[model samples]
Target: MDSTYDLMEVLNHIDPSELNYQDWINVGMALQHEGYSVDVWDRWSMNDRRYHAGDCEKKWRGFHGAGTPVTGGTIVQYARDQGWTPPYDPGTALDWNDTISTEGVVVDKNWVEGREVTEPRQWDPAKELIKYLETLFEAGENVGYVVKSWKKDEKYLPADKGAYGRTAGQLIELLTQCNGDIGGVLGDYDPEGGAWIRFNPMDGKGAKNDNVTDFKYALVESDSMEIEKQHAIIRELELPVACLVHSGGKSLHAIVRVDAVDYPEYRKRVDYLYEICKKNGLAIDTQNRNPSRLSRMPGVMRGGQKQFIVDTNIGKETWTEWKEWIESINDDLPDPESLDDVWNNLPDLAPILIDGILRQGHKMLIAGPSKAGKSFLQIEMCIAIAEGKKWLNWACSQGKVMYVNLELDRASCLHRFKDVYQALGWEPKNLKNIEIWNLRGKSRPMDKLAPMLIRRAAKKNYIAIIIDPIYKVITGDENSADQMSNFCNQFDKVCTELGVAVIYCHHHSKGSQGGKKSMDRASGSGVFARDPDALIDLIELDTTEELMKQQENKAVCDACRQYLDAHFKWEDDLSQDDLCSSFQMLNYCKEKLDKWQMEALERNIEAAKAKIKSMTAWRIEGTLREFSKFDPVNLWFDYPLHTLDQSGVLGDIQPDAEQAPWQRGSAKNKKNAKNRKIDRKTALEEAIEGSNFGEKPSVNEVAEYLGVSERTVRDRVKEHGGYTIEDGLIQKSDEKQDTGKPD
Candidate 1:
C-alpha cells in the first residue's frame, strides 16, 4: 500500500470499560473503516487522536527554543479552569504560574525557554473508547431501520400538524411568508401563485417533470497550466465548486445552482457562464445536468438522489434534516482535544519494547494458514502497545504502533474489539498516544509509501508497524531474494533509525508442518523471513474436541517424535471429552509448532553458514587440485561471491552441486541462469503443483523416491516429506495420468 494506506484507520470500536482495552480497539476499527492502520494503546498519559487530526492554525511565533522568554498558565487545565480547589487541588494557580499564560480562562502554552514540561508518556485511552461508543450510537440508528418518504402525491411530512394537508410548494411559500418579509422574498408571486405557463396547464412543483432539460453546467475549457495563470476564473462566477483530477491533470468544478436559474433572464445567465468557460478554454459539460432530473455531479446529488450516503426515498424535509444534522455536527461540535494533546507531547521511543516485537526487528514472519488469525494476532499486538497491555497474554515492552490492515471493515473490527474488550473489562486513560492510518480502496506502492508513513507515525515516539499480511502491500517479485531482501532491508533500517519495532503477519506455506523448519512457511518473500531483527511464526493446532476423539491413545512431543521430552496433557475445563480444548488446544498447538518451525529455520541458517564455510574449504581443496600452485593468485578467481556470499558458510551444501563459486560456474548453474538451481526451481514448481498436498507420505518412502539422503530430504522438505508421510506411496505429481485399471 502507499502513503495513502498509512492514512487508513484502524477498524473496531470501544465500550464503557474501565480498562480501555476495548476503546483502543474501537479507535483501530474506526481508523480501519476510514482506511487507516493503527497501533494499540501504548500507555495512558497523552491522547493521540487530536494530534493526528487536522485544524486551521497560526503560530504565535517561530519554533520554540530550549531556553527563552515565555509566558504560561497552570500545568493542568481542570485545576486552572477554576481556582485551585482545596480537594485534589492543583499545586500552582493558573494565573500565577509564570511560565503559563491564561486568556479568557483558556489555557495557553508558555514559550518559556528551557521549561520542558515533561508530562507522562502514556496516551489517553478513554478517547478511543468514547469515539467507538459514539459510533455505536450512530450504528444503532442505522441498523434494521428505514427512512420512508412521502410519495409523489404527498406534499407534507407525516410529522406536520395543521399544515399536514398543504402541498410542499405551498408549505415552503407559507413558511417563507411567515418569516415576515413578503415583498423582498416573493415579489409579485402570490403566496399560492404561479401555474405552469407552457406545458403545466396545472401548477408544477418538484413533480418529476421528466422534462430532461439538458443544460450545460460550468462553461469550458482552459488547457494545462493556463487555469492556474488565470486562477481567478474559478471564483468569477458563483457556483458550487469541486476538485477533480482527470488524466493526471487538475480541474475545478462549478455546479450551477438550479434554483438560481429560474428567472426571467435564466437562459441568458446560463449561456453567459458557458461562453465565458469556452473563451477561457475550459471543457464545459453541457450534458451534465438535466433540469428536473436529480442526477448531477457527485456532491451535487440532490435529496432523495444522493444514493450512497442519504436515504433514497427520503422527502426533502428529511433530507434537509440530515443535511442540517451533518452541518451542525461538522460546524458546532469541537473535538475535546483531550488525549490528542498528551499523545502529541510524548518523546520519541525505541523498538526493543514488548520483548522486541515478535522477534527482534528483523523480517519476522508470522505464518499460518488462512483463517488462522494472523491478522487478528497482529491487531492484538497493536492493542497491547496502544493500551500498554500484554502481548499474547505475556508482558512486552510497549510503545506506539501502526497497524496497516488492508483487510477487514471498521464495523467487523468493532465486533472484534467488543469481544476482546468485553473480556478485559476496563477503559484506559492514555489512548490518544496511539496513532492510526486508515488506507482502503487504493492501489498504492507500499515500497514508495511505507517509509514515509512509518516516519510520519513516529511522531512523539517511533512507531511500530505491523502489516497484517505482507503480500497485500508488497508489489514486486516476492520470490526474488534480491528484491525481497532490499524491501525488508529498508524496514530493518527504519526499525534501527526510528527505534520502532516492525512486525509482519504472514501466511504460512501450503500443507502440514509434520516435522520441519517453516521459514519457507512464510508467505511471499523468503527474504521476508530473512530480513527483520526477529520473526515469529504461528501454527494452528488440533482442538480439544479432536484430541478427545483420539484420546483412546495419544503421544506427546517426544513420544510422537515431534519434540524432545514433550508430554501430552489434558485439561478438563476446556475440553469436551479426552480431546483438546478448542481454544487452549489450538493455542498450545500453535505455540509448539510455531516454535519448532522457528527453531528448525534457525538451525538451517546455522547449518547453511557452517556448510558454506566447509564447502568453501572443500572447494579450496578442489581448486588446489586443479591448480599447480597452492595460491590461486596465478589463476583468475571468478567465484562471483561478494563479502556476504563468501561468508555465508552453510551446512546444507548442494548434494551433487557446488558451493558459492561452484554454484556460480557449474553446468547446472549455467542451465539455471537467471536464478537458483534446476533442483530449486523443480522444487518450487512441485510445490506449486501440489497446491494441496492431499495425503502425505512416510519419510522413508519420500527419501527413497527423491533419491537423495533421507537427512538431506529432511533438511529440505522436512514438513512435507518427514513425519507428514502416511503410507509407502511418497512420490507426488500434478494431473495424475490414468492407469486404466479402474473406472
Candidate 2:
C-alpha cells in the first residue's frame, strides 16, 4: 500500500472530535505540516451553507508566521487544543515503514571449525564506501539491509521499521554500527509498493503530492545481466545513470536520478529497458520495476562477499534535453486535438436574452448614483423578465430571475419589493419565478460566494442573477486594475460556467458624468465598464415640469372647489350629485355663443365643464405612471401621474435627452458614430496619402471606399482646403502631384 494511503486510512479512522486535547493538537501539527491550512477548516464549515464557524481565523492566528516549525507531535497538540481526538495509536501515528522479513532459518556451522583450518576469507570496506552510502541517503531511496550475525543465517531488515534508515543521518549511523551488507530500492522510498508519478520539467520535487512517493531518480532493472553487461547497456543508451549496482542475485539495477519527467514517464523508460533486455537476450526482473522495489545498496556485502559497484557515470543535463527524451518515448501514446478544435466546433450566436439589453451567458452592468433608482430599474427588469413581458421597449426573454441585494437589509429590500408589487398590481403568486436574496450583512466576495450561487442557480434553474450593489462583494481596491480583474474573473466564471446572465448594479464615480459617456461614469477601474456585455445607466430625471404642472392643477382644483362651496353651499351634507348639479348651473349661466346655440351647444358645454370640475378633486391624487422599456427618447422611467394632458404615451414625460451623448439612434448608428470625427479624419488622410492618380480620387470614389456619402467626402475636402477635385480626380496645388511614377 502507498504511504499516503496508509496515512489517510489512519486519519480517516481516527475521530478528531473524540481525541484528547493533546492528541488533537498533535494532529493539527501533522495536518499543518502536510499542507492543510487553518483556513481550510473555516472553508469546510462554510460548505454546508447552514452555519458559519468563523472562529478558526482567531484560533489559527500567528500560526503561519515565518520560521514556525510544524511536526507530527505539534500537530497532535494543536488538534487536541482545538478539540480533536486522535483515532490512531499515538506511538505509530506518523509511521511510514514497510514490513520486512525478520525471520531466518537456523543452520549448523559445526564441521567448518576443523575441516577448513585454512585462512578465513578477509573482507574490507572500499575507499568510496562512505561516499557511496551518502549518495544513496541523499537520493532518499529506502535502503534495505541483511543484519550481520555470528550465525550463518541472516535476516533482511526493512528501513520502514527503523531497522534500516529513514534519513541520511540514520543511514550513516546504521551503516557505521552494523558494517554489513547494504541494499535498497533504487527508486524513492514510500510506505506503499511504489508511486505512479509524473515529472515536472522545471522542478521535480516541486510537483510533490501527499499520495504518491516523490523521487529524484528513476530506476531500470534487468536480470541475467552481469556487471559488464549492465555497463555496456548504459553506455549504449548514453543514459545518465548515477550508478549501477550488482545485486546479490543474477539481476543488475541501473539507477538514474530523475531530472526530467516524473515517475510515470520514468516507468515507460523502464519498459524500454525491458524491451532492450528482450532484444539483447538479457532477462529482466519485471517485479523490480516497482519504484518501491528493493535493490542492492552500493558498497555493501553480498552473501558474505564484498558487493562491487558496477559503474558510476553520473552526468548533468538540461531540463530541455530530459523533456525531449521523455516526449520521444511517447510516440506510441495517443495525441488529442488542441483548443483550435473547440473554436472550429462552435455554432453562431442566437438572439440576445433581452434584445439589446442582455444576452444569455453574458454579463451586464447597471450603474447609477446612490439612491438614483438603480435598484428600482433593475427590479422592474427582473419582474419583466420573469413574466416574459416587455421592459420599457425591450422584449424580455422570460426566465427565472434572482435578485441578490447585498447592500440592503431584508426589511428594506422587502419594503422596495412591496412598493413595486403594489404599483404593478402583481400578486405574490405571480412572482413565483423571481427569487430575492437580501444578503445585507451576510454576503461574501464574488469569488468566495460562487459555489453557493452556482448551487442555488442550478437548483432553482435561474437564468439571470441581479447583483444589486456589486461593490458590496468587491473585497479589494476598486480602483486597482489587478484587484478588480480578479473579482471580474470570478464573476465571469459564474456567468459563463452556469450559462446565466448577470446584471450587477454599480455606482457612478463622484462627479464623473460631465462630458463622459454613460458607461464611463461607472465607478472603479474602466474594466467595470469594459468587461460587461452591456452597460446601462440609470439617472434621476429632472422633474421640474411635472412638479410645476402638479402645482398648477392643484390651484385649479382649489379655485373650482371654492367657487362651488361659496355659491352652492358645498359644505356638510353636500352630496356628489348636488356638487355636479351646482357646477352645471354655474357653467350654464356663462355667455353662450350665438352660432353654437342652435346645436344645443350651451347644454353640451355646461355638461363638459361640470364633468371636468367634478373630477378635479380626485385628479390631484398621485399615481405612478406606467414605465416603458422601448422609449429611447425617454430613458427615465415611471413618474407620478397627473391630470394635465401631454403628448407622451405616459402623460407629459418624454425620454430624457441622450444620456450617452455619442449614443444616438439605433445600435448600428451608435457603433458607427463611435469616434466618428476622429475616424473620418484619419480615413480621409489615409485615402489622400494612398491615391496614385497623380491626385486624389473623385468625391464619389472616396465616398464609396469609405462607405460614406459623397456630400460627406466633399465637406471633408473643403474643410481640409489642401486639395481640389477636377473632373473625376483630385490635385494637390503645391506641386505637380504624384506624376504617376512608380517611386
Candidate 3:
C-alpha cells in the first residue's frame, strides 16, 4: 500500500454513528489489512454510542485474510460520503517530505475498465525505433541505448553503461540504411531480453543524472499492477505522456513530461509526479526516479513478448497545463454557497476599527502631496487606535498597533512619535500597545514583506497595521493597473492573515488636486485608491492673509493667557475683549508686569508668531465603502500636530483644483476682490494712525507706508468712502459708513 496518504486521517472523517454495522466492520477490516494496530479502530469506534470497549480487540483477532480483503480505499470512500474533503493545494510548492493527499483522484480502481494492448500485425523494427526516438528527443540530442543484458538474481539487467555519444539523427540515418536487419546497425541482442533506452536526452557522456542535458521526461512504470490496469490509470490521470510504451513484461512505461529547468527542479517534479501516480492507484516503480533512468525500448523482444508503442500524446499537451489542471481540481477553495441557505442566519459584520471610517480586517489609504503631513496623520491614527481615542473627528477602537516605518531611520521615527504625542498633549499611557518596525534602508517589496510581517504578528493580536509612505515598498509600476492591483493584494494578504486593519499613506500626483475627486487624487493607477475600503485624501487649502492674521492674533492671545495663568493673576484685571486683542494684551502685560516677566512674555509671543507662520492648512475628504460619505474635515498642520480647525476659518477656503474651471475663476475673483478692498482700507487706516503719532497723515507719508504712489493712495482713500483725502492729507469721513459688513 502507498503510505503517501494518512489512513488515520481518512478514518477520522467517517462518523461511526452515521455508518451501518457492515460498513463499520468494513472500515475495521480495511484498517487491519493496511497493518494498523487494533487500537486505531477502537479509538475511532468510540464516537458511536453503541460501541463496546473490548469489541474491537475481539474482532481484530479474528480478522484473517479473505479472498477479497477490504482496503483503505473503503475508508476514503466513506469519508467522502460524510462530506470530508481532502486538504491540498497544487500551486503551493511541495517539499521533499510533504505528505501528498488523494484529493484529486482521477480514477476509481473498482470501476476502471481495462484498456487492451495488441501486438503490431506486421512489425517494422526500424520504423518503431525511429518513431520512439523522434517522439522523445530532438535530432541533435544524444540517445543512450543498451542491447546487452546480464542475469542478476534471475532478472535480466543492462550489462554495463550503454553507448553514450550517438546522436538521434545519426542513429536514425544508420537504422534507415540497414533496412529489415536491426543488428546490422548496432550490435546483436538476445531475443528473450529486451533492449533498454534512457528517456531523457543525454549529454554525450555516461547515462547519469548529471549527464542529462534537458530534464525532460520521467519514467512512470509500475510492475506491481496489471498491464491493462496501468494503461487505464495512466490515461485516466491525464499524465502528460509523450510516448506510452509496453515494457513487454508486466508493466507499461509512461514517459511522462516533467519539463523541469534543472536537476533540483527535476527531482521535485518527479517526486510530485510519482506521488500523484501512486495516489491514483498506479504504484510507481520508485527506482526510476533519476532523470537518466532506463525504460524498455520499442521494437525489441522480451521473453516472447513484443515491445511496442501503445499510444502517443495521450493526455494534456504540456507539463504545466497538466499540473495546473490537477491543482485546480483539488484546490482548497471553498465551494459556492447558496444565498437561500444563509439568508435567515446571516453572519455578523466585521466590527468597526475606526468609527465611520473603516472596519477591522479592512484597508485604508491616506493620500496627499509631499510635506502635507500624511505620515504624521498615520502616526496620530496609530496612537489613537492604541489609546481608544478620537483621531481627528472619528473614534477608534483601542488595541495593539504596528507602525511599519519604511521611510525613516530608527531614531528619527521614534523621536517623531514622541514629538507628536508631546505636541498633541497626550500622555504615553499606552506606549506598550505600539510596535514600531523601522525599515528606512532595509525595505523590501510589499509582496516579500507581507509574509515576514504575518509571521511576526501572528499571535500579537494587533488591531491595526499602519505602514507610512508605501512608496518605499511598492512592488511594480504604479501606473500599470494590473501590476498595482497585484501590489495592493499584498495589503489584503496582511489583512486576511493577521485579521487587522491595514492603513497606509501615498502621495498625490503632481499639480493642483483641487479639481479631482478625492479618489482620483492619489498618485498612480486608480487601483491604489479603489482597492482600499476607505480612502482619505488631504489637499492643501489656500490660506488668505486675513485668515493668517486671525490665526496669529489668536496664537498671541492664547500665549499671553497661558503665561499669565502660570506667572500672574490677570483674570481679575483684564476683560474678554482686552484679552482677545493682541495689541491690548501686550499693553496690559507690559504695564502691569515686571521687566523679567515681560521678557518671558515677549519670547512666548515670538514663538507663537513663528508657529502660526509655519502652519499649513489642509482639508480631509473621505471615500468610504462601509459607511456614508462624510463632510470634509478641516485641519491645521501645526508642525508636529494636526489640530482640528474649530474656528471655522478654513470652512470657506476652497481647494485650488477641486472647483470647475468656469466656477473657479469667477468665485476666486469675487472673494479676492472683496479681500483686497478690506486689506486696502485697513492699510490706509493703520498708516494714517501711525503717521506723526495719532495725527492726520500726509498723503505722501501714507503712500510710502502702504508701498504705493500718492495717486494710488488718494484713489484707495476715495474708494474707501469712509475717509476723505484733501490738501495732501487723509481724514476720516463722518457719514454712517458701510464698515465692510453685511446686514
Candidate 3 on 1-743: residue-level lDDT in tens? 63645888888777776455677789889999998999999999998766888999999888889998998767876776556766842222222223324466667765778788887888998888888999988899999988999887557999888887999999899888888577776578887787899999999978888899999999998765567878888988999999999888878999999999999999999998987876676766687898989889998889998899988888999999999998888765779999999999999999999999999999999999999988889989989998899999999999999999988889989999999999878888999999998888877788778877876788899999999889998988999999999999889989987899999999999987888899998999999989999999999998877789999999999988898889777698988898889999888888878999999899999999999999999999999999999999999999888999998889988776656788778977979999888898898788889975888788889888888998998888889888875555677777335556431
Q: Clashes per prediction?
A: 120, 41, 4
lDDT of 2 by residue, 412-505 (tens): 7777777776666655554788889878888877766765676457667778888888778886999988899888887776786578888888
TM-score, prediction 2: 0.41
Largest lDDT belongs to which candidate?
3
- lDDT (Cα, tens digit) per residue for candidate 1, span 1-743: 22222221111111112112223333333333343223322221124322222111112122233343221221122222223223332333322113221111111111112111121143222222122223222221211111122333323121111111222244234434443332232132221211011111112222232321222222232232232422344332222332111111222223332223343343564564454443332334444233332111211112332211111111122222423432353342356766776886975433345542343243445665665555656665666777777654245555666666566665665566445544445375545644545555441455555555544554556346776656666757877888787677656655655666667766666665423344555766667655554555543332222222332122222122233225334333234432322234334445545666646634544443343332211111101111132211111111211011132222223323123556436635555552454465466335433533544445554455556566655455533332221232334434334455421
lDDT of each: 0.37, 0.53, 0.86
Best model number under TM-score: 3
Model 1 poorest 10 in a row by lDDT: 193-202
Error of 2 at 575 (Å): 24
Candidates 1 and 2, the one with greater lDDT:
2
TM-score result, candidate 3: 0.62
Rate residue 420 of model 1 by lDDT: 52
lDDT, residue 382, candidate 2:
82
What is candidate 2's CA lDDT for residue 100? Answer: 17
Query: Global CA lDDT of candidate 1, please?
Result: 0.37
